[model samples]
Target: MGDILIVDDERDIRELVADILEDEGYTCRKAANSGECMAEVEKEPPSLMILDIWLKDSDMDGIDILKIAKRDYPGMPVIIISGHGNIEIAVAAIKQGAYDYIEKPFNIDQLMVVIGRAMETSRLRRENVELRRRDVEPPELIGNSPAFRTLKSSLEKVTKSNGRVMLTGPAGSGKELAARYIHANSGRAEHPFVTVGAAAIEPERMEEVLFGRESPERGIEPGLLEQADNGVLFFDEVADMPLGTQSKILRVLVDQTFTRVGGTEKVRVDIRVISSTNRDLTQLAADGIFRQELFHRLAVVPIDVPSLDDRREDIPELASFFLQMFNRQQGLPLRTLSEEATTLLQTTIWPGNIRQLKNMMERVLILSGGKGEIAAAELPGPDAAPADDQGRVVLSGSLATLPLREARELFEREYLLTQINRFGGNISRTASFVGMERSALHRKLKSLGVVTSSKQGARIAHLDEQPAG
Candidate 1:
């Protein structure tokens, strides 16, 4: 049921074992010496290894290779076989991490039984690691707003199919949540759902991280791509991936195969890639920054996740969900948001989207203490400002009465809002006018709670149109 590598210098013995394993419904690869054995392991880690301890005409004997395999891939089970057997050799092999040592004249039934037990033991060890890794429950997509409903509907429609999905939206807008939702409902739900933060990894190590690495000193290290085999691989902020790494990823998407760094053997995988980005990938492709072919391969079904501002109606529901979730997680008594507090949240602008809202709820709960109900005063940031007829904040001498920090914040909020409106809510033009980088201005506007109109957001989304081939 799993791949097994057989290593022995005797050609006849290797073939006999291969034939037996193939008949038993287990995939098998035979190696005549240490070179081939290590090569096979580096190319793709096997589920179990059948190694001959007496490897002739090899630089590293079976025991030497066993140490490296055990050091690098602790999960894989290795069974050492030897023609010349002794108590000391058996004890040495076991000490070096061999699952079991078998003498040459081993009984067929005994060998099969040992293999079965070793496979089961490997499976249990993997499940144990997975359980610890997934102790936190998967995130749920929580909201009932029209925008939220549309996004949820789109995600549901694509679950049965394995189309590569590209989620486009602002940072902290629940793209990863939507990605996890798709993987959980898809056909590959039983397999792994591995995520690679494209921008978070350093450029120098991107290839090694995504494609894996192999070296004489370090042995073999499996990459994220191989880990996501037969499952979903989610790339967060894919636009930030380095150019060289992008090219390598494109090859993997096209051929479903890749080689680890410092290795020549190609390893294949079955994966469904789902990439997310806040930046416009199509524009980058056209500008020759991101590869054009890679864009097409990744954006087979592009879905835009709405910013929190577009889903203000869901604030009360989302707020309550976070509060309840926190209560369960922390073993604290349930708390409720006051009517005024809910209204304040719905009216306020969220630059960081759903993530920011979740964090704010947690902060409120921690500061609420013994209080059962959270009030408007407990909420972070200033209350929603009164807007004049022209949609500008009406200061009304509030600036003079407020502290220096609040007064500066108030002026910046009104100033940025006026400029944003004057520029037709175009973030790029406003950033240019304000002498700031587009990213910095975006962050500044978010901090000031300045909301951009749907039309401007639409214009930004328009940049994702596929370039002419």
Candidate 2:
């Protein structure tokens, strides 16, 4: 739970709300005027705010404060309170992004219900942001190879410039990781780090998704640009963006402002754009598939992420890191890779790059039953193969000697992996094949330390072909 900010000119009403909220186990702050409100907001942002629309004796009205608050903290949920009970004013407050409106002489029960719902919305929104961060942001840049070192050096310079960066690399080649590293080192590290997958968004709703909409039914909704104000906005697979959306994004970079769909109010954002693509943007611009001016704008600082094949020296260390990470995440016993296993890992070409390596390591840990040592035979082929028709695992090393419990767990893990690979890493299809709900299968995979990315052709650990018994 987070603290609540209550803004009202009436001291008694403020105190009453504060007491009620405090009794409900919420920390409440009182603001009598716009000055106090802004000062409190600057000191520390509240999770949800309650503002009285008719603030008598205040230099700035409630609507003015609401506008400023929404502009500064677009994600914060706000509830407007008014003594007059004017519907028009309430509608206006919603237009300014209020979560809900309450008339004065309000029922306390209703107020509490609204407050609960608003706080939950705020909590969920924050959780969504955190999940996005976890999904895209790497724990750290995990390599000391020569190629990695050179890329890190270039990133250090780019971080300081705050110019639009264009990261080009193959699929799963750590472009997003590099973008995150830049954001982590830059001045905007404390602020939001938002990632938008340009290729994932529907082309028809691209404008509405990026710039938001001012709908008569849904009120004013802030877009990704406003959500990422004063922070880094990462555009992943940016070359796939529609031409019209590219032009709008270009306009934002050039003018530092954009009008929402069906809106005249230009929203100004102090954002640092970092765009990445696996495709050749230069060639796309040449083909007129992408806007030429947008490419030039985004490519002000171009970086090429090295493929895993080029950075094989980092393989052992990356393998160790993922081993430790999944061990902690899954509460599995710590396991170390043998010298032979490390050598084998380095020899392979990772076409899917770092992500493939990560997924493979996780799969190995789950299937190995947290055995003390990871031998070379426990790992799948460098280019992981598909499971055979009967879905039987090819036992290597000494699985027969393991304890019954560990052996069963390992067998179940292999079965799931085989099913997932059978479906081409499609969780829904895999769930159907396994006779389990999709979400339940996902939880099972997650619990077993299996990691699958939504990217096309992401690697899934599979068993080698074997003759039938």
Q: Kindly list the per-residue Cα lDDT of model 1 for residues 188-255, writing each as its tens digit.
A: 88888888877656688688777887654335657778888999989989998999888889899889
Clashing residue pairs, backbone N/CA/C < 3 A, model 1: none
TM-score, prediction 1: 0.58
What is the RMSD of candidate 2? Answer: 14.8
Taking the tens digit of each residue's C-alpha lDDT, what string does model 2 give over 191-302? 7777777776668767876787786644777777888899888898998798888888988999999999999888898999999998988899999999999999999999
State every prediction's TM-score relative to the real structure: 0.58, 0.57
Candidate 1, lDDT over the whole model? 0.82
Best by TM-score: 1
lDDT of 1 at 143: 75
For every model shown, the clashing-pair count is 0, 0
Q: Report each candidate's C-alpha RMSD, comma-separated, in the order given.
A: 16.1, 14.8
